[model samples]
Target chain A: MQTESKSPLELEQCLKCSICTAVCPVMNNTDAYPGPKQCGPDAERYRMKDIRFFDESALKKCLNCKRCEVACPHGVKVAELIQTARRDMSQHGPGLREIMLANTDIMGSLATLVAPIANFATGLQLSKEVLHATVGIDHRRTFPKYAGTKFETWYHRHAAQNQGQFKHQVAYFHGCYVNFNYPKLGQDLVHVMNAFGYGVQLLEKEKCCGVALMANNMYNQAKKQGQVNIDSMRKALQGGVETIVTTSSSCTLNMREDYPTMLGIDQKDVKEHLGLAVRFISRLLDEGNVKLVWKEGFKKHVCYHTACHMARLGWNVYTLNILRQIPGLELDILEQNCCGISGTYGFKKENYELSQKIGSTLFNDIEATNAEAVVTECETCKWQIEMSTSLPVINPISLLAEALDLEATQKANIR
Target chain B: MKYNTVIIGGGLTGLVSGIQLQEQGQRVCIISFGQTLLHFSSGSFSGEESNTDVQALLKNAGIATVAGGYRLTPLGELRPAALTLEGYYHSETAELKEKSFAIVRLPKYLGLPIEFLQDTLTAQGREVSIITPDEVVGCPAEVILVPACKAGYDLKKTYGKRVSLIAALPPSIPGQHIHAKLQQYFQKIGGTYINGDKVVRSTLQTDEKGVRVQSVETQNLGDELIVADHYILASGSFQSEGLQSNYDHVWEPVFGVDTNAPEDRTAWTALDFFEDQPYQHIGVLTDEAGHALVEGRPVSNLYPAGHILGALRTDIQNLNDALRIAKNL
Candidate 1:
């Protein structure tokens, strides 16, 4: 069943308990924020009486991390309230920077078309300064580089021929990050699935998960993308695809949690299929349906940074459990800390400093662990952590791919 | 999906118990409906003062407790309470009776009436002075009673423990502070907390010995069954809906545990509104082992704690009882 819609009367449920402030990462880092208690249900009472009572800038400062929602004893939907307020306040439409960042699929496609020039241009100081001045993207941050070939294109050339031959079938919803920026992760996902005797194919025509769009207050665009993704996923499911899996935790959470709850895609079949879209590694391990053949002498020290949405989705344990299976691989989990690059929120020049400040704890923890490399489930977290630290951050699936004996899979692929 | 223990509420008792169980290396998960009643707490724990064991447990959880001999209530009358996160006005001993106090009132601050406080303090044979400060900083009074505002301003930092915050009308600051600390402590020790979901129904297994809870189902998370070896029902009293009363009778809603209450509906409340009400003590009666009983038979795996234990004066007894039952577990 879907979660009941929170009514205006639910605002009265706030006991004025300032408990939300204590656990709020944003409040802990900066004094500029009035904390979720004040900005959410507290201000909501006033806003209900008069829409003029809204504080547009203060509301934007929220990371929408849902830490406040978790800390709230009364189920205040503090993050949802802040997001709704941002949506209502931006009724006139979002700024140019927001509009640009929200459309990841378009930018990703164009960037991949001119991969070398785009990657080189993003690295140059002069280009960064010019882009910052024009588009409000922070100059100091390093943009994720686009692959020479997108995942969909690579899949057609390499992996698509082997589809439908395996005993198990899983439709991969490779969100824009894995599709354009890190196609290797998508390839790794396919290789790992194929090694387990499961055939992997891309969803018929998936769109961006729309997490950035929803965060940027582009509700209509997010809804459209959600509908398209759902339809594509439904088509794949109808064609005997057993499960829908994703490499990114944020994208998985968007389909599993935000779609029905926030985006109003509550059709019975859609909800059932959405339930099938489990975290890739967790589902495989939990069902006990696949056997992982760990390569002998494969060992490394891996520190995991649990992405906020992954933790909220309750898949961090799954990631940890699967990673720990590697023999002699010493795993250290960083404290539950937000990476602070929440979709497009951290990309803005105004939020660059706050984003870094919020992520500093995670960075320091990673450095302290002295792990050979860092692993996380969310691509946004991967980019943020890698940019902030010297260690290379990779997905768990990529790490899993490395541990597999690729000779066996390559032989199977040749057959 | 499976844990060593599944605690029903996320209030002070449920959280504390969860932490204790997790420390014992049990996989614990706390399922909560929404806002805990602790939001109405005055941040004070008042009970049999000699029970240092419970106080030690609280201290172990990183919550510093002060003697808090007597503190002025919102009604202006002084009452005995054992407070946590003590402000300046909350004295550990009765020496506060001899001290000169100034009640500072801020403009447009309607939390506490200065005249009521003055009258109550004067009635207690203490001299009281009232001042309306333009700002809380640089006040001349040795001890100032200010509004209970914790955000945007830190009275303790500004006035250095000399300023004691009074409980505001509703969302109490001290209560919120303690609740946050408890939650953080519980999580730090590897306890899982699931908020914003209510346990709609529980699957029960009956055997020759007795009945035991097999798994619990929640409202929002569809089709996911939360299975635990042991279940702790700390859902609290009427405030959080642990115990429900209709025109005919009172009963625990979640498990339908038999409640200890007067059979007559007329005996539920007292004649005076300020006096102790009988219904306040009506809750799930438990066995000597703290296992909740249904129709005079104990559910071997179900243990009841906190306000749901049918104790009188819940604020005083909930924590102590919770600690006692949780330690034995």
Candidate 2:
């Protein structure tokens, strides 16, 4: 925990303005969580004597919402404050749930053993509720079930299909969620890459990007995790992978922006990765790199929900611009503030209702659009949208690669 | 109302005038709508004389030591007055200390936070410190930062960008539009201001002790009594109160505010014309005791201040002159 050194004069300037709260979708839904201003500087004012406190459930409730930062008049850094508070609580003996959540590297490696058992465990009606209760998670949400086969297993088996695509190749970073829960998205990404005439190599020997750990305020752990990820990316770059492509928006944002400040990685290399590696499935197709076989008679209306992490990294417009190129697809740009799932946020039982409330705006927007499908770059957003709406929510590349008539993509979708 | 004195206009001059009177153990009631100072203030003080020869003219008009800038030595007595001043020139070291700790104005549209900005600057090896005054009424930064003055709105969030909040008094979009609304609201909240009430004549009520300003006739308000133990004349510059020469004699409305002004506005105008002309000498005559001169006798309470009555140009520099006038009062 950081030493309490900020003065009362420093704390008094907050003015109790709820502008920060107004923008936080997490606070909009959850009653237990005071918005950023309240939990942050507002709460900082009323505490007796010092800033140190024991329990920090209120501080950890921030869904990593960047909206409050945008709405603040005084430019109060609410996100950093919340993260610091969480770090303080974690140091004061963070419970087993937090430790388990923060150590994704351990979880990622254990996926092979836990995959089937996890599915069976999650199948029990009371399992998720019990897990939420133990972890301080709100009781009304569901997590994505683990995939039958992990993404790495699939990537290694089909390594020889791209005999001689483009000389230029990209290093693929399949994040934990895409690797465990939605492995097919990674497989679809390969097909999309091949059609675009690029040599795509999966950096299967990668660790958790640790962005989630950082969000949960496990800074030192996040730094260590970031170093491992950075080393893997650095090696891939040395092996002639010009750009690092990843399906996860959170992973892309971390590698592109956060890693440089947090880990002192080669800033130029990171920027190059940002300029090129940071791309969505629909974006690759729009860039004319991926060959899309548009379904002969399929004409559909779809809305794209820009993810908050992706939006903060400034990749939102690029995704939207790419979507504009599809011939028969009518796109509704859903100005979603946040999906409110934010990885683990929606799955927590305590936050589930708040997540639903925060997500209601997006849910209503998707419903109002009356689109046949909802397309987004993030798998968590896809899951959150799927939970609320009856419309099919799929990865943007899955749609684009299907349009390209990739035989494997067609085969996978039919199943 | 146990008011020993009622000071009108809540701008810098008025506030300082009241502060000085309060320090002197007098009960001072300041009537202000609070939109007197222009929001954009640099807060520098230079004490140089304007070319207008107003001090010399006032001297010729039989008034010897009109209050001006002083370089206070260790002895504490004000030294010989400097003619022209700029920004907020302070004669004492105490005032200089405040200026060094002044916060730079942070403009809007810079999408960086104050801490981040500070970190970035510190990384670049620049020494930047911020200071806040005691009373803050609105949008305080993550740090409880206050403006240099009451009307100082532009906050320093970045190296160079101005930021201010739009109060919802009149409800408009929150930029310059809201600022305009607040300014109008300030005018309304301040004491009675009959719009377009132009003062044209001055009358003196002389007694054994001193000459008192009896009343003045405005074009609209007619004869309004400005009765008080003290009077502050801060009607602003020529653009605000019109100090133009009709034939040859240079004069101002009500009490001949700046009696020693240039016969022709061209004489006081700048060579660049566009550049700020140094015309601090264009002001009313005053006796050596820092009292206003009515025909040759000192008016006990009538005080000339700000851009209107000046030994220095307030625009280019004379902030210290304004401060001194307020402090001495």
DockQ values, each candidate: 0.18, 0.01
> For this target, which candidate reaches the highest DockQ against the unseen true structure?
1
lDDT per residue, candidate 1, A1-415, as tens digits?
A: 5234457525765766666675577877787898898899989889888989898878888988776665565556787788777776655677888888889999998999999999999999998898799989999888999998999999999999987678678888889998889999889888887877778978777899899989888888888889898988888888888777777877777777777767777545855445312345555566676666667788889887777777566555456557656777787767667888988888999889999999998899899988999988788888898899989998888898888676564445434
Best of the candidates, TM-score: 1
**Candidate 1 iRMSD in angstroms:** 5.6
TM match of model 1 to true structure: 0.79
Superposition TM-score, candidate 2 onto the true structure: 0.51
Alpha-carbon runs more than 4 Å astray in model 2:
A1-19, A30-34, A38-50, A53-57, A70-77, A88-90, A108-116, A133-139, A160-165, A260-268, A274-293, A406-415, B1-329
Candidate 2 lDDT by residue in tens digits, B259-319: 7666676677679866766564577777776677767677877776666665345532433
The most accurate candidate by lDDT is 1
